[model samples]
Structure formats: C-alpha cells, structure tokens
Target: MPEHRSATTPRPAAPGAAAPAAGRGGAPGRLLVRVRERIQETAEAVSLVLDAELPYAPGQFLTVRIPGGGARCYSLASSPHTGEPMRITVKRVPGGLGSGWVCDAVAPGDVLEVLPPAGAFTPGPGGLDRDLLLVAGGSGITPVLSLAKSALAAGRGRVALLYANRDPDSVIFREELRELAGEHPGRFTVLHWLESLQGLPTAAGLGAPLAPYAGREAWLCGPGPLMDAAGTALRAAGAEAGRIHRERYFSLGADVFAQPAAPEPPAEAGVEAGAEPAAEAEVELDGRTYRLPWRRGTPLLDVLLAAGAPAPYSCREGACSACCCRVLEGGVTMARNEVLDDADLADGYVLACQALPLTDRVRIGYA
Candidate 1:
C-alpha cells in the first residue's frame, strides 16, 4: 500500500483574519511522493501517481524539480476532490530532456520535489452556471482534464471537451476521460480530433457543435500554433475575450539552439591575465541595456544572476529553452545548445544561460 502526503500545507492566516496565536506549530513540508510510474504509450507518454494531496484550483500548475537538473511545470491531471494521491499525465516529446526523463527513467518510490501551485489559469465564480468549453491539443489535455473533473465533482454539469491528438494510441488518459463522459451522459460531451484516425473531426468540422457553446467560457491549451488556431475559431464563433483562457508550456531548454556564434574580439582586446576584466563585453535584455564588466572567463549566467535580474531559466545546461530570449539588437555565442532551430537563430533569439557576450552591447527581453 502507498502512503498519502499532503500536496500543500495549511497557509498562515492573514493579518486581520481569524484565530491561532503565536508559538503555535508551524506548517509541514508540502511535497509529492512518486507512488506509481507506468508507461501509457511507449516512448510517448506516461501516467504518474503522487502520494500527496494536491488541493489545487482547476487551472493551477506545479513545478516539479528534476534532481540534478531543473524544474518542469505540469498541470494536475486529477481534481482536488479526488482525495489523497494527486495524479499527472506527462507526454514525451522527441529529445525533450525533462519529459523524456520522467517517462523513461523515473520509477516508483522516487520522490519529486514540487513547488506550490501557481498561475492564473484557474477560472473564477463567473465560470460556474455556464456552459464550459475546453479545447486542447496533444498533452495539453492535462489542465483541461483537471478542470472537467473539478467541474463534475462540483456539480457544474454543462461541460464539453474537444481533445486533439496525432492518433488514437497517443490519446492520453483515454479510458478515464471516456468514463467521466459516460457517467455524465448528455451533460458532458467529448470530441476527438485525430489527425490520423479515419473520420476524425477537423478544425472546420467542429464549427457546428462548438457554435452552440460560443457564449460559454472556453479554455485552450497545447502547442502554440494549435492554440492560436483554436482561439481564432472560438472567437469567430462569438466567444468573448474574458471567457477564454490560454496557457502555454515551453520545454526547459528549447532556446539554446537558436543563437549564433559570438563575434571575435578586436585585436587590442587580448585574453586577460590573473583577475583582470576583459576588453569588450556588454549584455542587453528586454529593451534594457547593461554593460557586462569584462570578467575573465566568467559564465554569462553567473553574472546575470549576480546582477539580480529575474532571467527566465531552468536547466542551466542549455538543454532547456526556459532561458531563451530574443536578441533585439546584437548577437551572442553559445557554449552548447540542443534546442532551437535555424529560423529561431536567424530571428535573433538566444539562450542567456548558455551565451557569452561577444559584442559591447546586446538587447534582449528578460521575459
């Protein structure tokens, strides 16, 4: 039997809020334990069970730390009312470091350090008493699944889910979702979008069924382009801005491969001796400019971290694209990059963690 763990500890009361005096016991640590790790579709996705109680709102996400690497944010696949043992279904992308590791190497009894839930994906009171429409692609179903389950448990019966996948085999949580829809009858409807399946619905084919729920709150998630397309269709059907929410999931080290090599220093700027500063160095981020003091062979990320810039980053090894930023001005050189593409590199994108300033000034976005 697996033991249960709390997904989140009780939060301290607000300043003017209720009881509990000082010297009372502090809160316990909130962590999720790996109770079960099973392969769902070989090399594609996996189903994981955490021995923790995650009382998460419908659209929040948890940042799971990959030991010796970095964190990967994932939406809770199970609803809060499901009781102890939270669940998350992860889909593996080709050569994706974190997703691949979770799907291949992670095992039972392994503990995953998880940060508290965060994000504005959760819907408010307005979402209740109205038809709920969800549009998801591939693994983007995670958060939507949670929302659907939570809505059902709360007795908000008017809900519909449109899930798109490459094929039937790649459809995640297929049985569970089917069961949920079956239990709810006419109150719940799930449409499958299979690119490879015969007679599957396409973007245009979905217009009719989704049109009726155009006034409903719509939640969209998945690949960037796919989400954009769905949003366009939903809006055209009359869904309002406030009623639609979109969330994007980026791989940890996807941007490193997008940077070009740094230009060589001028002849006068030779390699420094001892602790002397380099002759030419500068870094720019998010429309703001910062001079990189010529530190002798110092890692660029170290300098940025020391400067107190809230640079987006995960897996400093250039494997995750979390640190990727656009080079609005100058260029940079990369130490290593397994992410990114030729077009991205040509478009002036660079991974801050793996880049060193080769010019005097460079502009980028901390965003």
Candidate 2:
C-alpha cells in the first residue's frame, strides 16, 4: 500500500534521468509507471491506479503522455491522507485523444510515461484547517473528492461539496462519497444538482444551496459555464473573491514531452541597446540554486532552461500551472496567467513560463 500523508515528499527523477527532459521513457522529465488496476467509475469515466508510491497533494494533477497521442493532465482523485494507490480519474471526451485513450484503450499492466505531479491547486499553507466549500461539475469532481477526503481525514475543517452532474447515473464517485459522508457525518455535507431534473444550473438557481458555504474557502472546478455560475453565486452570497480558488480544465495544445526550443538571444528578443544588464535571478530547483542573467522581456522558465537548469514545465502557454514557483525575494509579472487565483498571487506564487522579472535580483524556489 502507498504511504498516506498530508505533506508531499518529492519523488526523485526516474533513475538514470534528469529533470523535465531526460527520463527512462526517452523524454525529459518523464516517469514509467505500471497500471495497478483499472476501475470504471461511470459509463464515460475510468480511474487508473498507478503502482508507484510517489507523494502528491490532493488536487495536483499528472501529465500523462500517450503513446501516439499527446500529453493530457488528469487530476489525482486518490487522497494522500488515504491509504489508497495513486489514482487518476479520466472521463472520455467526445473526440479527445488523451482522455479517450486513457479511458478506452489503456488497461491494467500497461506502462505509461508521465510527468510528476505538478500544479498549485493544493491547499496553501495552513489552509487545510479552514472550512472548505467545494463546487464541482461533471468530471470536475475528480480533484474535489481528493481535497474533501484529505481535509476530512487530516484537517479540523468542515467540508461541503456542491456537485453537479448530467444525471444520477453520471455522478462519479457516488458510492465513495456516500461512504465518506457516513464516516464523517458532522464534518462532511454534499449537495447534488442533476441537470436532467433541474435544468442547467444558473447563478440565481445556485444561490440557495451555496449561501451556507459562502464564508468558507471556495474551490471551484468544472466546465466554463458551471464554474462561472458558481463563482457568481458564491460572490453574491458574500464569499470574498480572494477566498475563491478555481481549477480550470483544458487540454494541452503543445507537446510537453518534446524537447523545449532554444531560448532566443537577449539582444534579438528586444533587450535595450546597452541597457543596464538584464535582471539577475537566483533560481532554486531540485535542491540546487543557480544564478542566471534574466533578460528583460524573457520568461523565467526560458532563462532557467537555457542555463541547463532542470526545471519542470508543461504547456508553456500558461493555461496549466505545471511550471508554478514561488518568489522568495523579488517580484515578477506574468504575461498571462490562467490558473493561479488571487490567493495564489498573494502567496507569492507565479507561473514561471509567463513570468518576467519585475525587479532586479529576483529569487524563486521550486520545492
């Protein structure tokens, strides 16, 4: 059985490999894990149990590289506080190569190439003890369940879930949630919304059920419409905008498993002629610190990779939080940030792929 704990212990890169780029799978920063089991959660959803004991927080996701198909991120539903195998639930999307392959073709005993767990979706420092409001729709329930279980088992907070689904039979983790509720009757509450009976959820319609959780830390995941409505409803019910965190689901459009392109020259990439030397950045990654000259107008990830630093990243477009790092000293600005919420920004977290140095002598760490 996998060790269960609330704190994450970093997993070493696959033996004989380096960070993000060189791995046993012939790709940088990939690991090969065997499928321990395959579970059908619903008609369109399946959960794959991996036979590895690496550490990961509740809401973090794994980037799995399909053999012929590209990479796709799937949230881990298994709680680190629970003695369950590392598992990721995948729902087959109408023509999605990654989700479709994981759900329909992958089977027990198959080997998969995956990037280690990455994302800033996990609870922040001391966040586990705060009351939680989890709003999930469709397959968004995947990460929601993980956070709920982790909190119930490891924290002192009350947990409530407002889950929306297409219909009764389409609710993933139905029995598991019931068991959880039974285990912690006073600490756990679940409100279900079935579209077949209630029609599509609207902000006005969700106000009643979401009002009770308005004061709690909100974590929203699901489709665009559902998340938007939930956010609106929460805010209307008095939830502070900074207290609401969200995880957006999107398919990776770039090949994360491929080698990254060479960084452009500082002078060619629009550095001022004979301007003050580019800001200096001290990057802490994989237990080593490297100082590099971060050119203006260049993303931090580009600077790190160019200097042969073993930083992990996926989807340089900044939609995914795979390249998240924290600023310990100076500040940086993100060109585009689709994942981090206001709370994350307030906590000094930024997407390295989108970050440009805002001050000289910046220091960032990825622990």
Candidate 3:
C-alpha cells in the first residue's frame, strides 16, 4: 500500500498500546509539561524543548492552551526516530495571543497545558523508503525539518529541501540543516531561497530548480501563496497529484480546549417532533467497541464525549483532522470541513467533530 494511506487509513491497535483517555467535556485530555530548554531559532521564532515524553510521529502537532485563554497548535520539530527530546517551535505572529506568550513570556521551567500529539500531516508506516521532496516557507520548516532528519537518520532514502525565507537572518535551523547536508552529502540536499535576493517565488521560476525531484513524493507546508506556487511548479514539472501532500497553516479561531457546546435537538436536523427516540451507534476506538445513543442532530464527537468514550479529537471546528474516522457501515455529513481532500473523503474519512449521522445504524472506526 502507498505510505500516505496510513495517515488517512485506520489500522488495528498493536498489543499493549495505550487506550485513548475518556473525553473531558468533549476535549482531549491535557498534559502539564515543563519547558526544559528554550532555543532562540530566530528573531521572531522560539523552539521549546519539552520535558514530557509521549508517543508522537514526526509531523504531528500539540495543541497548547494559551497562558490566559485560547489555544494554538504547534508542530513538533523533534523526530521520534532520533534521540532528541520532544520540542515544538513557535513563531511569533503579530497580535497573536498564543505565539506572543510563548515567545515573550514563556520561560524554562514554566508549566504548559497541552493536548497530546495530534495531526494527519505525517509520513505513515514505511514512508521513508522512497526519495522525498520537501518545500517549506518560514516556520513551516518545523515539521519539514523533523521529517528530513528522520529520513536521513533512520531511513534509506534521498531527501531534498527547498526552503524559502525573508533573508538569512530569518532562516530557522540554518546551522542544523547545514550540518545535515555536510554529514550526508550524497543523500541530503538543501536549496535556500532568500526573498531578499530573489523576489517572491513564481511557479515558472521554481519549476526549473524542482524539476529534477518532481517525480519524488512531495510534501509542502508554508504560507498559502508559497504552497500554491510550489504545488503549481511541481505539477508543471510532472509531479503526480497523488504523490504530493500539503499541510495547511492556519490559526484556530475557537478554543479547542473549551467545553464543546451542547448539540442541537433532533428537530434541528429535520427530524419529526414525534420521531422515534435516538438510535444506537457502534463506534470502534482504541481497540474497544462502544454502543452509544446517536442523537439525530448531534455531532459524533459530542455524543462520544457525553458518554465518556475515549475518542480522539482536537480543533473541534473541523479545521484539523485529529478527529478523523472512517464510516464502515453508514453515512455522515459534515457541517463544515476545512481539511480532508477529495481522496480522503472517497476513502470514507469524516471529521467526527463535524459529522451528523445520515443513517440510524451507523458504524465508525478509529483504527
């Protein structure tokens, strides 16, 4: 099977794997972690080394509660394949509540409340056997760096990175990337595009430099414009659509840590006032099957949370795929979905936080 499928496809739980924690008010359980060290990556970006150890893939992210209120998701910069401590890089955004606190106020030894690692932007099982083409802009390099290092250190594949930034002063992990290139001259390659020297990237311009590696599996993350340009360039250079993956960069508008609002009544879903009572839903999660009442208008996440089922989720707004699950026996419709492409939908994936049942007897699995 193709490697990216693992990110969207559910698989059976391994023996001795930890079960999901029961939901707390429809939010994933939180962990309090101490900041072991803080590295100044750039003028506006800071990398926090967390003292906590948890199972996480290289490209996953942690949803952190802001010091005051609200929350933000920061991608992991450390690779689990390597022996590095868990770390997350935060780039300060103007007037950003979460980034501002972490960059300016957060100090070593400070305790932080964060959800466990969650995200679908990861290279799945056996993902590092083939050559990889990575593109990053600004802080998007965080996860890209993790994947690059993991491929170089643990896998047998060639890795190429095309990183763009405002200028030399703005490049994060410059020294480390240099060291990697030096260590693996044949297997690793780096290309830096400083906007200070080259104007904003264009598809036609980037196509030439990326043409050679266009056939490789490509992963892109950065600002929307940069990603759009890179994607266009790759496609023009003969990259297959299925071989390219993208990570959208966004800030959550709602606090995922907040208690989920009560679901609307069945009438809201066009169910008759005197319709039959809610039906039972069979949900498979963490190797356990749960029988819960499926409310007509209620989202699956809310029902599971109310029942104390251990369902996985982050960004209840459907902006992230942490709550993604497959519908095996029935159908569901999403109220709103910002993630999950057409291929993902065709493969039976749905965002549990936004899903409303379309069938009374629905069966779902988290693999």
Candidate 4:
C-alpha cells in the first residue's frame, strides 16, 4: 500500500478507476444548499457553486426552487471527478422566474432549496474507453460540459464537443472550453458554430466534423431541430442507430410542474359541467398493488402519489424519464414526451408524470 497522507492531502484515485458516479445516491427529494460562490460566464450565463455535498452523475440535473420564483430544472455544470464544489449554470431570460432570480438576484452565502439530481442522460459507470462525441446548442452545453470534463478527468477516452451558439459574444463557457482543450492536448477537442457568422447549422456542416471520429457514440443536447439534423447526419454517415442519445431542454414558466387539473366534484351527485368521470387506478410497484382514485385529466403520477403509492418521479417537465412506467392495462394519454423514442412508445411505455388516465380503470407497472 502507498504511504498514508495527512488529512488535508487529496489522495489520488486507484489505477484504472472510473470517474465518480454521475448521479447522487438514494431517491430524489428537496435539498437545501448555500450559495458558496457565483461566477459569471457571460452577460446572461452564471455558474453557482453550492456548499451542499451531492453525489450526482454527469448529465444529471437539479430542479431548483427559488423562494418566490418557483422551480425549474437546470443541468449540473461541474465534474464530480474533481471533488470541487457542485455547480449549476443558468442563463437568465427576461421575465423568467427561476433563472431570472438566480441570475439577477442570488449571491454568495444565500440559501436556496433544490431537488436532488435526477436524470438518465448520464454516462454509466462502465469503463468509458470508447470515443465520445458531444453536440450541444445554446444553454444545453451545461451537461455536455460536465460529461466531457468527467471523461477527460478519468483519462478514459477521447472527447470531442461541437457547441453551437447565436454568436461569439453569446457563447457560454468560452474560456473554460478553451482551457479544457489546452490542458488535455490531443485528448479533448471542441468546435464552435455561430449562426450569425457561419449561417444556420446544417446536417452536412455538422456531419463533416464527425467524419474523422469513426467509432464514437454521440450525446446530443439542444434544440429539437439541431438534435434531429445531427441524428440524421450521424445515422447517414453510418453511426450506429442507437448510438446517438439526446437530452431536450424544457422551459416551464411559473408553473413549476404542469399537473392535469382535476375538477372538484360537485357536492351533489347531479354534477357540474365539464366534470370528468370518477376514475380509479391499480398501480403496481415493488411487488404490491395499490388502489388509487384517479381522474381523467389528472396525471397518473399525481394520482399514485396522492394515494400513497410508491411512484418515482423527477423533473416533471417530461425531459427526464424518471417517471416512465409501462401501462399494463387500460389506456393513457401523454401530454408531452421529451424522452422515449418511438420504440419505447410502441412498447406501451409512458411517462407517468405526463400521462393521464383515459379509461375508468387502469393498471400501471413500473418498468
């Protein structure tokens, strides 16, 4: 064994060890953190260093709740491998609730509540020896940066980033990305595409940079069009069909979560106009079944939670697939889907957070 170091000394990781996990331990819940430091990345982008010690995977996100500004999910911006303060980047928009408050108001030592990190857009614990291709747009660079840094920090594989922005002035983490490329030498590379300077991005334009990386799996996060175009290009260029993964960014306003509203039943059995039928559910999880009161418009996850059923969920905006479950019986209607490719949908899978009960009696099982 190597000689023991003092308490203040930061020990090195064991040889061949992978980077720290990209997700925190245990189930998701609300956590309070003190703002330790705030670094401005651009006029609109800011990175917050939280005092809280959270064990989260790269590409995961936290749903932060501002005291009076409501809650919204933002991706983790720092690498867990560095053991530095956990950080999140926010690009504020005018009239925005959470982002605006965090960017324009919060400061060091201020306390804020945040939900535990929850997302499946993470690279697994497996030895990431394979090449990595990262494509990001606008604010989607947050999680991509984390994953790239973690992969480089672990000294596991080559990482390439193709970042798109409106202009050079609007690029977030411009300096950090340059520093990363410089420090890592040949292991890490980055390409910037500015719409104002290079015209709008195209499949051929983005595909050209990816040609050199013959055997790389891609992770995409950005606007729908960019992701779709890149996916098409990569697939056309012979990249494996399922090798390109994507994470969509959702902008939910004052409504932290959009729950399908259940109209209050009338005191009398005569009922009121537009009232939905009294629906019920049989939800199965952990080998047990629970009967719950469900309404047509109410989200299946809400109904399960209200009736004390153990249903897991995070980032109710539908971007994160934490609430996904299989509909075993009856029918459900999903309001939105940022996750779940066509195959998963064809398999009768639905996000419980966005799915509404369509039939009077339904059965759902966690997948």
Better of 3 and 4 by TM-score: 3
Task: Using lDDT as the measure, name the better of candidate 2 and candidate 3.
Answer: 2
How far does residue 243 in candidate 1 sit from its true spot (Å)? Answer: 1.1
Q: Please give the clash total of every predicted structure, in order.
A: 13, 5, 0, 7
lDDT scores of the candidates, listed in order:
0.59, 0.78, 0.77, 0.69
For model 2, how does the per-residue alpha-carbon lDDT over 1-367 read when each residue is reduced to its tens digit? 0101011112212221224321355544567888989999999999999887665777877778777756777888998787988899988878777777888899999988887676656786566899999999988888889899999988999999999999999999999999999999899999999999999999999999999889998988888799899999999999988777777656566777765533564333225766766888998787788988888788988888767676666677777776778899988999987766666688788888899998877999885
lDDT of 2: 0.78
lDDT of 1 by residue, 1-367 (tens): 0010111111111111111111211221124455565546434777677765534556555556665555577666777645635676677767666677778788887767654443335555545456788888888887788888878777464888988888888788788889998999988899888879644444466677678778888888777666676766777898876566776544444222122112222222344454343434354443455655534344455555555433434345654344556666655788876554565577666666677666565555433
| CA deviation > 4 Å runs, candidate 2 | 1-23, 261-278, 295-298, 306-310, 331-335, 340-348, 358-360
lDDT of 2 at 252: 68
- How high is each candidate's TM-score? 0.59, 0.85, 0.88, 0.70
Query: For candidate 2, what is the TM-score?
Result: 0.85
How far residue 282's Cα lies from its native spot in candidate 4, in Å, is 13
Put down candidate 4 lDDT per residue, 1-367, tens digits, no spaces.
Answer: 0000000001111211111223232222345678989999888888898887665667767666656545677788898787877899888766666677778888998876665555556665453566799888888888889988888887478998989899998889999899999999989999999999888788888778776663587888877788787877788788886667777655543344333222232122214366765566787664578876676666776666555454555556565675667778888889987667777677687888788878877887752
Question: 13-83 in candidate 3: lDDT tens per residue?
Answer: 22112233222223335667789999999899999999877667667777778756687888889997889
The lDDT ranking, best first, is 2, 3, 4, 1
Model 1 weakest lDDT span, ten residues long: 1-10
Cα shift from native, residue 343, model 2 (Å): 7.0
Candidate 3 residue spans exceeding 4 A from truth: 1-28, 260-273
